[model samples]
Target: MGSNMLFVRDITPRKVNFSLRVKVMKIQIMNGKGYDSGKKTLELIVVDEQGDRIGVNIRHVLKPKFESALREHHHYILRNVVVVDNPVRFRSIHWNHETKLMFTHKSTIIPFESSQWTGPEGFNFLQFSDLKSPVLLKAGVTADVIGRVNSYGNIKQRGQTDDIPSKFINFELKDLSDVVVSCTLWGQFCIDFYNYMKKAGEDQCVIVLIQFGTTKDYIGELTVSSDWNFTSVLIDSDDVPAISDFRARLLELHANDNSVGSLAPMLTPPTNDLTKWFKDVKCVGLDDLRPDNPGIFVVHATIIAILPDEPWSYIACKKCNKKANTVDKNVDLTLNIDELLALERYCKKCGEKPKVQLRFKVSVRVEDDYGTASLTLFETQIQNYFDKSAYELQKSLPEDQDQPDELDELLGKSLLFKLEVSDFNRDRTYANYTVKDATTDSQFIQVFNEKYQTHKAGDDSYSFDVVKESSTSKVTSSTKGDSTSTTDGSQAVDLTADSDNSPLKKRIKTEPGTSPMSFSSSTNKPN
Candidate 1:
């Protein structure tokens, strides 16, 4: 019998089976601060049934009456508050100067948290001791990760707390099966992870390997914290193991009490040949690939262009460099200014700004199988193939030589290229390769010429063809040179205009736009 039939039978009056409907109860609300055009206010509360509260200070909530009530009183509660899940956290706020009001609000909020939650049956939990140190996993390891995220305090300067600023991001590690502990990343890692989470949302799973951490408690629940000395974190995505299938195997191994050595290292099949695979493969936009693990991919491309090389310098005026001021002075006016100005205003090492030549770059509008993208090529790479250093080539050219010769060659030529793409996090990036080889293919030129001719001819159906043929005749021939064994047998045919009977008179005209004239005439009696 089907499960639905069983359910129907149980619900019927004739049946005596008993069932219960689950209802969630008990809510906790968090207190947070918010601001508007006129006043600072308190915002909505984030709560869980377990009596945990997370503060929410969204700007949109400030426009409603709830914000005013919460601000006047330290707290306010709605009797039958409609529970909305995954409210966006305000990441940034932008205001309009003219209107003197908030114009835009940016937040990191997801509508569903299911992608960030793990159930008992979801993943296989390995004990901390069983895992090896400095292990690596591929990007394809798992579909997603579910864990509790917490924010640690910012990093302050040692000598002056007001100067250099940094942030720390901490995550409490738990899965469907077991709870390990917590891990924290400082400085750049904190910034990178935060950006990745904000962009990837809750769907993408990030594989994190923890080193040297111990269990502890913050308030009442048991949590893990990393000691600064021994622990480190790395995101791995190489040779992604069979996580889903491994769950069953893991349980069997535990039942058998097997050691970690008994398991073999996971291996992945080799990647396909890029040139062969990508030739017919369709793309929409900007494609990104990374040789490294944890890569980013962006699709759909347009407005494809390249930026040529420009000169850069390492030095500037010391006084103006340190000070937050702009300095403008000619290279030759050092003497008069130095006498009148303070010694502190001494002329630093200054010269006429060296003119830098811009190299040829290529840009293309492309669409990947998914979306559109813009691809650009730098002058250095183009010069690399032409056997010329960018500096040497640019310096020797005249100011009037606006376009470099190398660039002219590549103006319409197609070539194979690769690109690396990254979002907010530099670590979580990828690379992609385009397989078109523009140099060898002449088909593009032919197509271009045909299109040009069609437009000029005003008839799209016009076509041109070349023909070759052979004609023969018999004739008596004689040579006036000495007959005694001529050493050189080579002879030259005279093609100049001749009034005598000549074979050239019978040749057909091949040039286009000429009148349709004939060469052969009525034959005279030859006998």
Candidate 2:
């Protein structure tokens, strides 16, 4: 493509020496001479005139030789570079090559000069649908995804002492394909995203590109998350052609829709809808959880008691984060320390024996004014309520104490609970409601409630009317006319009838925060 330049796909092990003009996407400065048999090295990810990419390990001695060429998103020419096997388990990028390029004797890199042939930014982004691909879902397999921020959640930080606390937040990314992918950002990346949204003063049409992100199968659903130093985030990056094209396409698709730019107001709403429940997807009472209705519902409740003597934590496969089992097929729920360390655990999901970590699965009885129900809080949601993890809490206990004192704190604390309901939990009194998410923050709590129970009349909350939503239909408008349309990527009958249904937190401060699925016809944006 460029005089005498070989594309990344053309390189092979049969020919160890080659010349190529490539764009560098900086990888890590791998520590020590230790990894490569006493040769401390630097690895850079590079892309050719085509969007294809490969890992290039600068030989330890050659690391310094090429140190000055380590510019990200810059082009360069390599002469006489070598090839080696791609042996690492978690690859930097998702190229299917078995061998990687290397810097060897006589290898040299010079800055690429031709701007006319600059192919692309080298981002081979994963389709939103590809996030479910097992190959990409590997613990460290980097996945790149691009979409406009559909919705987001609060910035939740946790640390026993506040020194370098573990901070994380979740959001959704939606493509023009109408597919929505869940995203979670950790550490400083989470903080950076939070700051951007805080400044925007409200959630609006912000397009984001997550590069080198890791994917996880959270429960049964897939999620893409930032991988510490390996990942980079791009927000409304106008200079990048791909992003600009995507934004323009999004605008084109709904150009005349009139409801443009109404991304569920971030800083303030035009009205006093500070406590506006999104799309009028009202919050429900605990007693409102009926067997016929099954969808994720947010309820404000307090923990009444921790169901004791039940399993509070389980051994989780470190790689896949699923329940790990002993060879004989027993859940590692009650393994003693000696037995645990001596035995091997298997993860059916990964099909491999893996090291294990303790994870929380605490069941607590919670109560709203209407009634009390049992809920099973898992590791992700429980960690928000307790500074310490189940393992840490158990380790801190005295020999005679079976439960952690942290359970004492969860009691009486009113929280906004996002419960995922299916018909399987029809018997609300006995059914263990599995939590999708929970928040103790009052600001987020208010946004979660539909006026905090407008359904309540006297003490008989059950006496109030309940909206029977059909899977096939929903009412998107209040006018008495049959309407049909899609709502948040879902098929719905905007019936004059109520066949109904279901349904981001940047801080708008004192305002009801955003939800993972929210909508408004606001059409307002920050300048």
* Cα lDDT, all candidates: 0.28, 0.60
The TM-score of predicted model 2 comes to: 0.53
User: Which stretch of 10 consecutive residues in model 1 shows the poorest summed lDDT?
Assistant: 91-100
Q: Which residue runs of candidate 1 sit more than 4 Å off their true CA positions?
A: 1-45, 48-527
lDDT of 2 by residue, 1-527 (tens): 33356887787787754688888775566654445676656767677778777778776777776776567777788888777777652354455676788777678778865574567765778888776665555444567788987655565544311223367767778788878787888877777776676555343577788877877766555678887555677776777777789879988887877555553222211111122223334477777775457676777777777877555776677655567667875547465544664577677767998877776677677776567666766665556567886777767778776777787766775667766665554433225656655655443444444344454543323222322111111111110100111011122211121112311112222222322221111111111
Model 1 score (lDDT): 0.28
| Number of clashing pairs per prediction, in order | 38, 11
Best by TM-score: 2
TM-score to native of every candidate shown: 0.20, 0.53
